[model samples]
Target: MSTTFPLLTATAVLPALGAVATAAVPAARREAAKWLALLVSLGTLVLAAVVLIRFDPGGARYQLTESHAWIADFGVRYELGADGIGVAMIALTALLVPFVIAAGWNDADADIEDSDAAKQRRWRPTQGFFALILMVEAMVLISFAATDVFLFYIFFEAMLIPMYFLIGGFGDRAHSGGEEDGAKQRSYAAVKFLLYNLAGGLVMLAAVIGLYVVTADQLGEGTFSLQQITEARAAGELTMGTNIERLLFLGFFLAFAIKAPLWPLHTWLPNAMGESTAPVAVLITAVVDKVGTFAMLRFCLGLFPEASAWATPVVITLALVSIIYGALLAVGQRDIKRLIAYASISHFGFIVLGVFAMTSQGQTGATLYMVFHGLSTAVLMLVAGFLISRRGSRLIADYGGVQKVAPVLAGTFLVGGLATLSLPGLAPFISEFLVLVGTFSRYPVAGIVATAGIVLAALYVLLLYQRTMTGPVEKPEIAGMPDLRARELAVVAPLIALLILLGVFPKPLTEIVNPAVEHTLSDVQKTDPEPEVEAAK
Candidate 1:
């Protein structure tokens, strides 16, 4: 199952190289830079698809692995591999980048050089914007494929740099409080995000050290290979002290929870998502943040089984709280983008809840949630972005009777909203159903409370639709809002198609994910509970 061809490395490195090339384009050729970025992302997608195709569901747990000496002294190696979970994430990341580039095509063009001050900036602002995005894609791909703990952490923390600049430098120009105040807000959000994650990464660094120390003592050499540690534990060759393991788990989990922004630690999300441009917002929720949840399944459960079980009760409680809190806050939001931000927090709750639920169905649902939520969120947010760009406002109160003026836009928006609420025929419904079924089997009380989130989701999504799309055109600004153009439609239509295609036939993803879910549950030494009632044969 391991390969010498280094396909995973190629998949990750291509975008990085493209990022440099795109950024190097002359300041005036914004169009050329965009095309270069798009081409590079498309190439990455092809490589990711190849990896998915070459993978065998019934093959080795980690396939297409490449290992070379990295740091002999510390036992770190340049290692990469993919399981079903990793491949799915890689596919999602690669698939979304092209659309992100297209959707944000003109986002950086405004104010590119209105002042002598603006003209002095080194690289073209437009090129830098797209380059930053591609750079993030490269880092995320490596995070997904990385088999070395140190390697994962390195890229994990590094991604924050580009994100910080993206939020602060290229923020939306529509300033509610004037341009000066808008600049301040972006600065605040960017700082808050960086400080929170950096704090968590520091804590995680301590835990990473703790984990390495444990492995070193047990194996007679320090190592950061996830595969090596996991195999050793499976073979009864490596054992961690309870106290040490719990501390390590807490450290790692804290970092991911902050990144996941699991409530209490989640305050930074609304600002970050609200302040960034729409494509970056999608990049934040749909792409970058999934790393937190994915890391939980890969590292937390993989490295510390007993500690994970010990922590499950509290984790699931936090998830339930996030679901309700995010949904409630979303219901009260007046801003279009912020509403989606709150809703994403709610969706991340479902994904996290499914992960901690531990049953095979739960894990599979969680992984699928990650994928479908990305698709649903992309469709919703990108369409919302287009709407905002036309009107130059993010406030919901500013819109009315959009359906009459721009029927196609309203229609697509409606579909996106329906998917967010997990309507039965939508892809999210499948993941949501599985999570509830899996949680109910193991913990009925938690399952019952979680359903309240569904009710609230319906409320927010419907109210959003009713207030914005269905009313009479009450403002002069609403009269000439054109419907979706070719570029915007190109960005959205594929995602909607995917939502329908996967909603009806999730067999493709399920077949790929189910086996990986089994492996994850095995790591945690858990199994699904038997049903109390069964259908008659």
Candidate 2:
């Protein structure tokens, strides 16, 4: 039976409405804004959960689709739907926002003892912060759910706005040398992020127009529907010269790669994460970045299979470079935030590598990596935020004997760091293992070379821990640091629980993810390579 509903549309829009409601309250009742945002986010989570519960994982196509033509001439439509990948991303986005709200409850407000000048200039109104977060959530959900290529582009670009303000307006300016200088740095990071993504968006826009033109020329009309374009290509009704298809593929791939913040193009990520508040960092790294990999699987490969295959060697090479380069950079970082940022770059390399490897297990591992990385990174960044909030510094040398002062906090940090390194029996390990296994199935040399990154991962993580969390208390300022507060525990406990839970029983998530991976591989018309057996001697 075919079921039709506007559930996907509702899930995407509710957060925006919540943002509006949060902003409507008077400034006098500003604290209420956090509660309101949380309420809205929780409601949004419920809606996303409903979509997941109702989703037919057994089905091979998008579900709960709602489409209506908005521009008949251009063939654009306001369409929304989700396959398994989309659903998982949406659910992760929904799950993270409420916790981000909890974790960053007072993050926008200036410290109580700050100089009047600093306070006056740097204080962000709390209502606006939460509102921006909710707005970003809405856009992310829409981007993941959007079936029309143009609509996806709109949401994709629109998301940059809230994220920009979140980074620029609410960043940790006090930690920088001076208030003015810190604000300037934040503004610079924001602009750089915007320009990089905007340049990519413009390239993608050109490719989108070219695709539309080709479709129009072939069928006597233009269309921006992904399903139609894919179907047309499958039926041999849409054809472009080999060079042109590859060019278009590169255009879209560049945007996604930049957003993936793949190596060489990844310079902006450390700056952004270094300056932004914890929750904003979480949003940028954990939730928003997934859009890049998701789009690669959904659009790049689905729409341009041969181009993707042709580009695989180059893409996998970049992914490998990202893994090794990001790990080495992380090992040398002085700032804690930048180290985590670099670690994320390394982790994203794993995700991208699994993606381009084009094996079912690799693809599944990549998808699972997306979810697990989000959970783990959120914990690491949030815990680092908690430490920074107490120590008033982001440098690695600023603290020592932290475990003695705050054992719970130290333990939490260790667990997060271990998870990042893909510790055995943790959520990330299973996915990372799968990604490498799948990669080895097709390209043994790349997989074997990439394994060295795990050693680098341990080096960076353990070094960070040993330097900051161990040793005698060298500074009097560190001795009295508080353990995790009730609220802090509340914020981090679920993430920790999920990490452990998923590590033990990843079957539920993989069950939902595998079918989607199989479907994507079918679209690309590729399968895992057969293994060679040694002859009996």
Which candidate should be chosen as best, given TM-score against the real structure? 1
Model 1 global lDDT (CA atoms, 0 to 1): 0.94
lDDT of 1 by residue, 72-183 (tens): 9998899998989988999999999999999999999985766867666675889999999999999999999998999999999999999999999998877678889999
Instruction: Candidate 2: list runs displaced more than 4 Å.
Output: 1-4, 111-124, 174-176, 534-537
Please list all clashing residue pairs in model 1, or write none if there are none: none
Q: In candidate 2, which residue pairs get closer than 3 Å at backbone N, Cα or C atoms, i.e. clash?
A: none
Clash tally for model 2: 0
Which ten residues in a row are the worst by lDDT in model 2?
115-124
Give the per-residue lDDT digits (tens) of candidate 2, residues 1-537: 135668888897899999988878676566788899999999999999998988888975888888898887788999877888898999999999999999999887663334656445433378789999999999999999898999999999999998898888889854748788888989999999999999999999999999888889997889989888888888988887889889999999999998988988999999999999888899999999999989999999988899999999999999999999999999999999999999999999999999999999999999999999999999999999999999888999998899998999999999999999999888999989999999999999999989989999999999999999999988887998899999999999999999999999998888888888998998889998887986789
Model 1 per-residue lDDT at 122: 75
Winner by lDDT? 1
lDDT of 2: 0.91
RMSD of 1: 1.3
Q: What is the C-alpha lDDT of each candidate?
A: 0.94, 0.91
